[model samples]
Target: MFKKFLAIFTLTFSLINVALADQANPQVVMKTNLGDIKLELYPEKAPITVKNFLDYVDNGFYEGTIFHRTIAGFMIQGGGFTQDLERKEVRDPIKNESANGLSNLQGTISMARTNFPDSATSQFFINAVNNYNLDARGRRPGYAVFGKVTDGLDLVVRISRSPTAPKGGHRNVPQQAVIIEKIERLGSESKAN
Candidate 1:
């Protein structure tokens, strides 16, 4: 009788673990001139934002883009401009998912928007340092944080430390372009970290 109970407990525990693994967040890798950065997105917390980002990834929207904005000790922004500093027209703006309870901690990725709150389209930024002020506060809308860097965070920090200058009317543009070669979704088994 004791052996049977132990067997049942083991089977239940195995099933639970499988479910947990199956529910793991989807991951993507952005191959760049600087280096590859792997990120895991929390669709459960910000479904709309994640879907929008994944759609851009699947459509190859981020390929050949340049990191158009960078600030030391702040964040690196990209996914909207070509290597030539031309802005690519993006799809309709997405709803602000900032209230999703995710913080803008170091390495976390958030939507880059204008002052109007819900104006986020294709542009996104990775926090190079803890940005608690970017989190949603009460009634004010903040940037929607949908993911975080899982690997190559040091590359992000390095990119933040790059020198910047005004270009095409945009300030803090990296003097040497950091090109995004491509962004690809990783299969569940393909997650490197």
Candidate 2:
């Protein structure tokens, strides 16, 4: 009887481990001119936003895009423009998922949107510092926080600190473009912290 119980316990433990591993968050590696940044998205919290972002990634929409806006100590916005500051055409806007209970903490990635609240399309931003105002509250529609940077945060800092200047009526545009070479989804080896 004792031997049987031990075997059952061991099997249960192993199964639990496998189940946890199988549920690992979806991760993507973004190779940029500055460096590589690994992001882990929370599909459980913001399913719609994650689906939209993953669609963009799978479609190669972020490739060759430049970090069009950078505000030191604030956030870095990208995935919308080219090296020459030309805005790329994006898919239809997604529904606002800001009520998903995620916060805009430092290193968290959120969808960039217009004042319309549901205007987030292809543009996204990474928070350099905690941005509580971007989190939804009551009836206020805030930016949808879907993911966070799990690696290469230093590269984000460097890009955030890059000098900025007015370009084509846009302020805080990085004088030296920080281009996104590619963004690809990672396999099972990828894990989000």
Candidate 3:
């Protein structure tokens, strides 16, 4: 009887491990002119946002897009405009998943939006500091925090602190336009683990 129970426990553990491994581990390598930022996406927590971001990445929509908004000690916004100041029109807006319980912490990635909650459409921001004010359940429905910078956060910080000037009808755009050269998945082997 004890042997049977042990076998059952082992099987359950194996099943749990397999279940976890079967889930897609979406990772993004943001190749910026300043540096590259590696991020591990959380699809379980923010499925819609992750799907949308991955769709854009897969379609090569983020390449050459400039980091259009940069505010020292605030956040870096981008994934919309090109170095030539042309905007990439994105698909329909996504429903705000800010209530996903993710905090807008430093180095975290969140969807950018207007006053409306469902206005997040491709543009995203990287938090420069612990922005508790941007978390859901606040006065305003907060931005949808989806992922965190697993690597290259220093590069993100440096870009956030870069000098800026108004461009494309938006303020705080980097004078030279810090562009995202490319975005790619690291590898299947690395992601599988």
Candidate 4:
């Protein structure tokens, strides 16, 4: 009986550790029409931004969204507009977390916002080149860098190279819609992501 109890306790402890490990730096995969982009979020560095993104992912908010804007050598932006160029309603704006020390380097994903700081909602962008200019500059609140592409970065580059034109009053809109099929957390039962 003593040996059996010890074995059960060890198993439970191991499972608990696994759960905590997964939560430490949760992984997600953004399924875009161009291709799949695997991302690793830095919850420790940008907890609020990461939580906001995960909340959208959990709610399937990105389904069928289009990578509306793509600028060569700049970045590919998406997650807010649909393929039809209609803007989706999003949750309230999140606080700026760009001072978390993360840079806007190539392959890194950052929250997309307007000229007004602290207005990032559901839209996000992936840097195609090192975009250090977007990093926090002292008092200026820069775009928040919450995650980076762990795999399929080549897909991001491809999306950035897409042909673009002005559409629906938005500039640099992709002529060919680059749709986001879905975004899912990596370690669920469908760990395929």
Candidate whose TM-score is highest: 1
Candidate 2, 106-174: lDDT as tens digits: 999999999999899999999999999889999999999999999988888888999999999899999
Candidates arranged by lDDT, highest first? 1, 4, 2, 3
lDDT top scorer: 1
> TM-score, each model?
0.88, 0.87, 0.84, 0.85
- Candidate 4 collision pairs: none
Better of 1 and 4 by lDDT: 1
Per-candidate clashes come to 0, 0, 0, 0
Estimate every model's Cα lDDT from 0 to 1.
0.93, 0.91, 0.87, 0.91
Q: What is the C-alpha local distance difference test score of candidate 4?
A: 0.91
Ordered from best to worst TM-score, the candidate numbers read 1, 2, 4, 3
lDDT score for residue 33 of model 4: 74
Off by over 4 Å in 3: 1-24, 189-193
Per-residue lDDT for 125 in model 1?
99
Of 1 and 2, the candidate ranking higher by lDDT: 1
Report the Cα lDDT for residue 12, model 4.
100
What's the C-alpha lDDT at position 178 in model 1? 98
Misplaced by over 4 Å in model 2 are: 1-23, 188-193
Candidate 4 ranges with C-alpha deviation above 4 Å: 1-23, 188-193
lDDT of 4 by residue, 35-125 (tens): 8999989998999999999988888899999999998899999999988899999999999999999999999999999999889999999
